[model samples]
Every structure is written in C-alpha cells, then in structure tokens.
Target: MVSYYHFQRMNKALPDPGSWDEYFETFLAGNVVWGSWFDHVKGWWKKKDSHPILYLFYEDMRKDPKREIRKIMEFLGKNLKEEILDKIVYNTSFDVMKRNPMTNYINEIKMNHNLSPFLRKGVVGDWKNQFTEAQNKQFNEYHEKNMADTSLDTHFRGLS
Candidate 1:
C-alpha cells in the first residue's frame, strides 16, 4: 500500500498522507485511490477458481524464482529450453530490472524518481523498518479482521 501510494503521489494522482500513521489509517479505512487492498485481493481470490487467473505472490517469487517462473511457463503453456529459462530468470531479477532503463521506468516524466525509485528495495519485510510497534499491532489486527473469511495465506515468512 505504501508503494502504491508513493507511485500515485509520484504521478501526481494522489495527495500525501502527511504522516506514517495517517497513511496506515487511510489504508485501514479503505480510502485509497483504487480501494482497500484486502477487497482487491478478496475479489480476485473469490473469482480465481471461476476465471483463468494466475495468482502469484511477490514473496513466493523472491523465495524461489525458478519455481515461480516454471509456474508461469506452465500457465502459459510455454516450454522453453533450460538455458532460455535461466536467461529469463537472470533478466527478470530485481538487480537487473532495477538497472534496466526499459523496466525501471527511470525515464517516465510524471514520476519523480528523485523522491523514490519505481523499484525501491525489492525485498520482503522492508515494512518492518517503517512501521512502529503500535502501528504493526494495529495492522496485524486489521489484517486478521479483514482476512478472516478468506482462505488466502497472508503470511510472508519474516514479515509478521
């Protein structure tokens, strides 16, 4: 949500939340530009079985890129050679993508990269650095409440 807010702010599509607490509060209230994150996920989770949805998680990809890439290949019915798969994994890595002008969005005029890069610290649990103890507790409670009805696994290893 923070990343999305930063992107929107950079594009001049949304106003700042002014403070970290306010930002989190806004998220919990579902007052974001697109809507609540949980609603978005729940909507997709509900429709996944009925639709041809290839639901993927960022943490899963980060944990095992080859496995995730293989899942994508299987979904798309693509059977590339092992060497090609290796190259694909290499090219799509966070470091490679961050450096690649085409993938990085560095040239985007609307985005203020000076404020925050489009691809900023592609790692799990970076939110730990930003969230206060109280905010984390609040967020966890909110997450539990929002996600109670769904079978979606929200756990992200060290994130919690």
Candidate 2:
C-alpha cells in the first residue's frame, strides 16, 4: 500500500495504468520490496531471544502512541518519568512531527508545496484514494502469490 501510494503521488514515474499488472509485478519484484521483507522476517525471528529486536508497527504506534512509547522504554530498560513519557508522546504525534522541519523534509525536495506536500496526510487508507479497482486487484493477486506459505505475520488487513 505504501508503494502504491508513493507511485500514485509520483505518477510520472509510474508505467501507464493500462499495463498495471506489469507495473505491479515490477514494483513488487523490486529490490526494495524484497529487502524490506527479508529485514522484517529477520527482525520477527530475532525478537524472541533475550537480546531481542524491538519490533514496532507504524499502525500500532499511530493507534496508541503512549502505549508504544512505554513498550519502547521497557525494551530500552528505561523507567522514565510519566511527565517525560507524555512529553515524548506529544512531540512525536503526527501533527507535531509534521510541523517539525527536521521530521517533515520541508526543504529536502524540489517540488511545489501546493502539489507535493512532504507530509501528505499521514493516514493509512490513502492508497484506497489512489489505486484503481484493477490496480488493487492486480496488486493483491501479486502479493498473495509472492507471500504464499510464509509465516510472516503481515497484520496489514488486521490493522485496516
């Protein structure tokens, strides 16, 4: 979904929608996708040991940031004050983060602000707004085929 929205925003970089199956194939088969998948799998497996990886989902963080931050603090073996935790949660909220130049990438790119916002609606369902029915179907088919028989807990639909 992230990739779909990204390509939709940079539509000029996308292949024509008439060849959406091919486009989805190429996009899903890219090194970035495979790399991310492998990394996620590695993290998932490693998160079971004493010195485990701290796995945090973006959706989980968005839904309950205070709880997520507490988890992070626990993972780091830190018992920060409640005030400090609240401050961290407030600072890291999407609205606050979006306004922060360091987090938002306001000056890093060369696009018109009106057309291309660095922080364009930090919500989950933006892909539904951009993806056509055909494109969505093709992407789902490709995704299911590629990810078949994997133990990876994607939790994507669950989040939605």
Candidate 3:
C-alpha cells in the first residue's frame, strides 16, 4: 500500500511479477522486484473489494496517522477519546512501530527469507537509491495507469 522496496528486488529494478488478468500485473515472483506495483495493488484491491473487509495502505497512515486511526475507529464504530488517540499516535510512530511486538512480522510467519525485523527503516522513498531511470519510468507508467491516483504512493519524496 505504502510502496517501497516491496515493489523491487535488490538488483532487478524492472521486473514484471506476473499477470492477474490479461491487463494488469502482480508480484508472483519468489522475491519482490522494482515497479511491479500494478500487479500488487490491483491484486490486493480486487481481493479486498470482493471481501467485506477494509484494506489500509501504509502511505495513508504515514501521511496522517491520527486521521487514519480515526477512520479505523469509525469503521469499527468506536469513538476513542482524544487522550487515547494521542497515546495511540505516540505509540504507533515509526520508532514505536519498529519495536512494537504486535506489528512485528516475525511473530506472524514461519519465514525462510532473511527479512529484517519489522522496522526496515520505516522511512519512505527507498527506491531512489535502487531504481534506475528506465526502471523508474516503467514503474511510474504502470503505477499511474493502474493506480491512476498518485495520492496513495509514498515512494516519491523528491530526493532525486
């Protein structure tokens, strides 16, 4: 949701993960690769739309977590008091998220991949260092056409 290296592998910046339908792509690769966003987002969105479930992306949280959290509370039909909201915000910041046990992926899976602890930098725009120009162009085209909304992408922070 909050796009990152999850779209790209360490070395391959322009990989086509696979196709969901005949039109869009998704990451069916053993390892993630650069710019396969259409596949990933579209796949998840299709699944989410089918289910009576909510899917929140990381970029939305990163941009205004309190707002997003309030949305969550509203969705759950709970009104968290302002004080509790403050506490949640303080505890859910990137610093806290990295260390928090509840959000750690290690507890959720029996992974064979050597993933870092839940705190893989937690900052945005890691792709600038990784993506070649051609790869970025391809990624952007796919993302723009499929996503059509730049609002959700957190990867472009203008570092370049």
Candidate 4:
C-alpha cells in the first residue's frame, strides 16, 4: 500500500492534471512536521548491524554543533583545520541555514500549497504556539502507543 506521504508526494510532483496520470510525487507532513524522529532512529538502529547508516538528532546538533562536527569528521576519517571546523559549525546553525536559500529551499516550497515555510522560527518551543493542551496529549499518546517498540525519545526541543 502506498503511504499517505508517498501518495501526497506523487500527486504534487506529477505535472499533468488528475484523472489517473502516470507519474512521480511530492509530499508533506500533515502538521508541518518532519518524519518521526524515533521511528527513523529505530529504523537505522535496526539496520546498524547489517548496513551502514548514521543517525543524527537536530536537537543534539543544535546543542553542540562543534561536537557533532567532530563526530562527522571522525566518521569520515578526515582532519580539518580548527578554524574550518568552527566555521562549518557556525555556518550550519539554524540561523545561518534559514537565511541561506540554498540550504533552506524556502522559495521553491513556498509555491507549494501543502508545504509551508521551509524554516520557521528555528527556536524550539514554536509548537506550543500551535498546539493546545488536548492536542499535545494526543500527540504524546500517538507517540507512546505507536512508537512503543522504538527506543528513541523526543523532547519538544526548540530553538533557544
């Protein structure tokens, strides 16, 4: 069965009109969200023994970009000048990426009805503005019930 995500993707990417057109896709998250962090982490974890994969958390990256940079350097077995490492970390921050059209891809997605701003307030607690208490409870329940088998965790981590 095609996933709602994939279906949405296919519908948008197809150039021609509807009425059963053969084509590719475009996708969006229902709540302007990204793919579930826990599921992705767990999926990569499950494949770790048999395949090569690297899992990263945006929160972790935000908290300590230099450390994340070092990890990437070590993973790729590359050494770089200290200044370059600092530059890379600084350049990759939410603030930097949001301003750089190349990184954010805001213009292209802006024309998309389903897609909103590629980068919102990079600050963490933005969801609080949009979700009510009841919605949050449902959000937690959804994760707790469906993501039960996954070991990953999520914090409503936002921009500081």
Clash totals for all models, in order? 0, 0, 6, 7
Tens digits of per-residue lDDT for model 1, 52-99? 988788888889999999999999999999999999999999999999
Q: What is the C-alpha RMSD of each candidate to the true structure, in Å?
A: 1.7, 4.7, 7.4, 8.0
Index of the highest-lDDT prediction? 1
TM-score of 4: 0.65
Model 2 spans with C-alpha error above 4 angstroms: 1-25, 31-51, 108-115, 158-160
Better lDDT candidate (2, 3)? 2
Query: In candidate 4, what are the lDDT values of residues 96-123, reduced to their tens digit?
Result: 9988988866434323434334455565
TM-scores vs. true structure, each candidate: 0.92, 0.69, 0.58, 0.65
Q: What's the lDDT for all of these models?
A: 0.81, 0.64, 0.56, 0.56
Tens digits of lDDT, candidate 2, 1-160: 4544343444444333334444455555553433445345655565566667777777788889999999999998999999999999999998999899888765524433554566767786666665677667766676677666565565544212
Candidates 2 and 4 compared: the better one by TM-score is 2
Which window of ten consecutive residues has the lowest lDDT sum in model 2? 11-20
- Compose the digit string of candidate 3's lDDT tens values, residues 1-160: 2233333221133443333221122332213443354556566666754776566766778889999999889888999889999999999899887677676444423321243344567665664665556556655665567677434453444334
Superior by TM-score: candidate 1 or candidate 4: 1
User: What value of lDDT does candidate 1 attain over all alpha carbons?
Assistant: 0.81
RMSD to native, candidate 3? 7.4
